[model samples]
Target: MMYISRRERFSAAHKLWNYEFSDEKNIEIYDKCANANFHGHNYELIVTLRGEIDKSTGYVFDLKKLSEILNQRVINKLDHKNLNLDVDFLKDLIPTAENIAFAIWNEIEAELKTANCQLHKIKLIETENNFVEYYGQMQS
Candidate 1:
């Protein structure tokens, strides 16, 4: 199988605070990420797909189409938005890098399927020192 990847960037803000926990506990658990005023990241997202090249087009999947899909499904929602308050898909979900990667996969998986592409991985770089990689969970 051939693999292709697309990279996109978005800036978003979030605070890793759980309402169920006290402020001290949240701070203890999340450290700097639990800042009350929120923090922002200029995130880099890498989406990878696996498929055989279409003989007629000589492409695994059209890169332009993949970019469009990403823009519509992920980047548009995330760019300049607040992951804690401004995003629909992220509502009630912690905006950690790991969770964001999983959320992005959910956001784009169906569209990729329709194009006969298997989503191979999602890599979310939240900072130079922090990132997450998610491969969708397998069904039993």
Candidate 2:
């Protein structure tokens, strides 16, 4: 088996909200992030795939297929959109980089099944200082 990876980028905005808390309480808890005004990030996404390379192509997976899947599913939905208001997943869940990473992983995983590939990991970089990773396994 061989592993292959691809990277892409998009910009989006979101806010964190907790329903259990009062509007004012959530605002105080999340501060700027809780603001209705929202904030944006230039997100970098890395997707890794693992599978046996095809003998004819000598590749674990086709880069064009991977890029197309990402562009069609992830980048199209997320790029230049307001995550909190525009994305169904983020409508309830906080749009933190961590949650966003998991959502992206789920989206890509669904597409990968049809392509005969396994998703290895998803890395989301919210900024130079903040990043998150989802490897699709429970840590012992």
Candidate 3:
């Protein structure tokens, strides 16, 4: 089996505070990330797909097709937007990099089925110091 990965980027804003927490507690736990004004990041995402190469196409999955999916389904919604407010999938969900990475996985998992490839992994980089990687729940 072979795995192909795509890199994409978006800029978005979010605040890490939970409304259920007291203001002081939110500040204590989330530090400056809980700021009422929110904050933005140049988020980097790496999406990987796993499958055997098609005999006819000689590709595990086409990069052009994957790019379209990432652009239309993910980037168009996330780029230059507010993750806490502007993203529909994230409504009432925290916009931390971990959550965002999972959300992106969920958003695109079904679509990838058409190409006979599995959504293999997601690596989300929120900053130079912070990133998260999630391998899907199974492997083949």
Which candidate tops TM-score? 1
Q: Arrange candidates, best TM-score first.
A: 1, 3, 2
- Clash count of each predicted structure: 0, 0, 0
Estimate candidate 1's alpha-carbon lDDT, on a 0 to 1 scale. 0.91
Model 3 spans > 4 angstroms off? 138-140
Over 1-140, each residue of candidate 3 has an lDDT whose tens digit, in order, gives 78899999999999997889899999999999998999999999999999988989998889999999999999999999989889998888878888898899999998987555788999999999999999866646
Off by over 4 Å in 1: 114-116
TM-score, one value per model: 0.96, 0.88, 0.95
Residue pairs clashing, model 3: none
Writing each residue's lDDT as its tens digit, candidate 2 over 7-26 gives 99999988888778999999
Model 3 CA lDDT for position 68: 97
Of the candidates numbered 1 and 2, which has the greater TM-score value? 1
Local lDDT at 63 for model 3: 93
